[model samples]
Target chain A: MITTAHQKIGTPSITTLSETIDNETSRSRIPGNTGIWVGIFCVLVEFLMLFSVYFIARIHNPEAFLNSPDKLLTIAGTTITLFLLSSGYCMVKAINAIRSDQSKTAFRWVNLAIILGFAYPIVKYFELSWYAQHGINVKGGIFFGTYYYLTLNHLVHVTWGLMGLIFVSYRTVKGGYTSESYSGLEAAALYWHTTDILWIVLFTFFYILR
Target chain B: MIGSAEKTWFILMGLTILGAVVGEAGNVGWPLTLSVVALIYIKSSIVIDHYMEMRSANQRIRNVLRLFIILVPMLVILSFAWGEEIRRFTTLS
Candidate 1:
């Protein structure tokens, strides 16, 4: 194991050391941090609740839902999906690199992830701008309202993931995490992956399942 | 050689493109809608098993996450097929 700063403290008593080892071992059983999973679980539930609303709206106004996607920019949605997926792949690479104690490689991978993550909002900006130019605001109808609500809600989550990625990338470069001590980096990666999966669902709802 | 993550990413990319192509139509029928749902389910499973590494996790957490992903797409398919009746049942009016 690489001697990271977290492990550089004065040698502790056998009890604490054994407990720490056990803790790390237990942590691997689930992967990532517990708090992140809690947050992810909540986010998943929230999205399901939103989809329930989608189901309701589609039930009553199936016509509106059917007519809406054609007016929107499929290119924008596709681009954003690409960005999110590419970024998620980079994150996975970062986690793998860090697990092997390759800090510099991990740093590059995470930085790449950050770049791709930021690409999402830039595309979203132009897409929303196009909507504005075309008079497709939230008040257009039930479909537009739901579209704006859910997409923006997803944007908020992406923003959060981007922030986490930035922080993790910074720390990862400085060797803040190693094979056995990467809870923070892993947590951020997990969170970003969660956001990616949610956005995939959102993309399917808004752009795919006309 | 490509690792699991890269392989997963490639599959997601292909599926996303496929979904985009499917969505380009003006009005999709139940067949396409269910097809998209299947894509969503497969993509979700890949993320859970590969990216999140949840297969080796505890039984309960794994089940909950898997169940949520499975259930939502199922609901979407159901609503797609039986929209009118479901609407009548859920609404107050």
Candidate 2:
């Protein structure tokens, strides 16, 4: 009977050790590369298209959409900022815990990160709903249309990030990631950070610099 | 970690609020608005490059990504600029 110690793949040579660790580090990845670059490109293109629509409308009637920066509330902006930055830190912490063999700690941190991720969209929901109630329809005018469209598009991205976090967290709890092999963790962390960075941009444009 | 993160957020939040206030067209002028936009763009770049860890990505990938980031925003703004020119021509006629 070949016990785990006798497993040829897990042999102790540094090269084998390196590959084994790398494999464990990223093993829970759902088959094939998630194509991290493609995901990044997708988000980039979406943001570009959104701005393109705004500029197209603006070009047609710049005077019509000369809006005062008043609809963006500071409270809403602060809430989102707090959640996004903290959630990113929590994800990093979770990765660190997993690397140190503290499975339970890793699980806890991932949960915390996921909770923060979920909270972001919820906060955005309240803010957006309020805007809608105030007769600020996305099609109300060029200004309202562009404003609502940009923020709502970003909210959708947040939803996707939250789901990804949930999946990654589940895998972490299942012992999919180890100190040596944790590519999935790296990929998830990268995704979460991208989401965080994108939100910062969204926040600045739609809220602070509106 | 919490302290550093919180401090950074506070600083950024303060700067953003100040920029917004100063950039208000009602108070400052169109120039300030443009300046604020510039600052926001710079800030966004920092978030993407640093916090997002794009700084450590493959060189080719990073270049491609950077090009898109620059070009996309410029194109959006260019559309608006072209529209303004068209509006002016119409007014002259």
Candidate 3:
């Protein structure tokens, strides 16, 4: 019997077949088209707009913006940094629990994530209170104004992040995530991570960058 | 991977506290300020790439976002330089 080499050459090559298989496997692995990408895009845009505002404000009033009280910034920074990162870490545990089909453990960690996030706004409120006492209202000089503006904007983001966590926690309690359909947990993790990461940026920019 | 990002966060936090201490130990002045800016750039990159998990993105996508990030600081630094020039020229006038 003649070998089918001639027919094989006429057919799509093995390399092409293997390439198709590889593509499908990679898609199955990550499933990037999930709405998590949209979350990432929103976060990227939000921060960029924020930095742009800072840039324009500084440009418009170079001299008047000096004299930041680093002490107030550091207090807020440290508190937020600790909790946001802790939340991210806790969220990883939650994701793992969901992946392993441990709903109770997943729910526990998700709650922890929410609690950590809830702490953020409280810390921010204390810092804002201190600023108010110091005559650093939202409409103060350029420095104080930007100080309040940037931080309050970030506070709003934290609020939104808290809402996301709360929703995720509710869903986890409702059996929305599992080893079989773990994308919800993955999506929530992505949001938690974004919040954590954005906080780091704010910490550095507001507290460290001077 | 998550653990690695967590470790990075710890390091960034440590550096932040250290920056605070340095700011407090003395005047925290321009040198410390410059150091903080550099540190912010480094830490923010880590956040964007690792925690945001954009490290594995397409290079073009990474570069575009990187450009945006880089430009902000550059503009900020330039403002200082231009501000100085404006002051000097006004004094001369």
Which candidate should be chosen as best, given TM-score against the real structure? 1
lDDT of 3 by residue, A1-210 (tens): 245876678566877899888765543454223476666667778777877667566556655544464445676777778788777767777876887899989999889988888888888778778877877676767766776777777777677777877887888889987788867676667766666656666665556554
For model 1, residues A1-210, the per-residue Cα lDDT tens digits are 467644655446566899888766654576677898899899999999998888898888988988887888999999999999899899989989999999999999999999999999999999999999999999999999999989899999999999999999889877799998998998898889889888888898888787
lDDT of each: 0.87, 0.65, 0.67
TM-score of each prediction: 0.89, 0.72, 0.75
Q: Record all residue pairs in model 3 with backbone atoms less than 3 Å apart, i.e. clashing.
A: none
Question: Model 1 lDDT vs. the true structure?
Answer: 0.87
The candidate with the higher lDDT, 2 or 3, is: 3
Residue A120 displacement in candidate 3 (angstroms): 0.9
Model 1, position B41, has a per-residue lDDT of 87
**CA shift of A29, model 3, Å:** 6.2
Chain B TM-score list for all models: 0.88, 0.54, 0.67
**In model 3, which runs have C-alpha deviations exceeding 4 angstroms?**
A1-34, B1-9, B22-30, B56-72, B80-93
Tell me chain A's TM-score in each of the predictions: 0.86, 0.76, 0.80
The parts of candidate 1 lying over 4 Å away from their true place are A1-28
Q: Which candidate would rank higher by DockQ, 1 or 2? A: 1
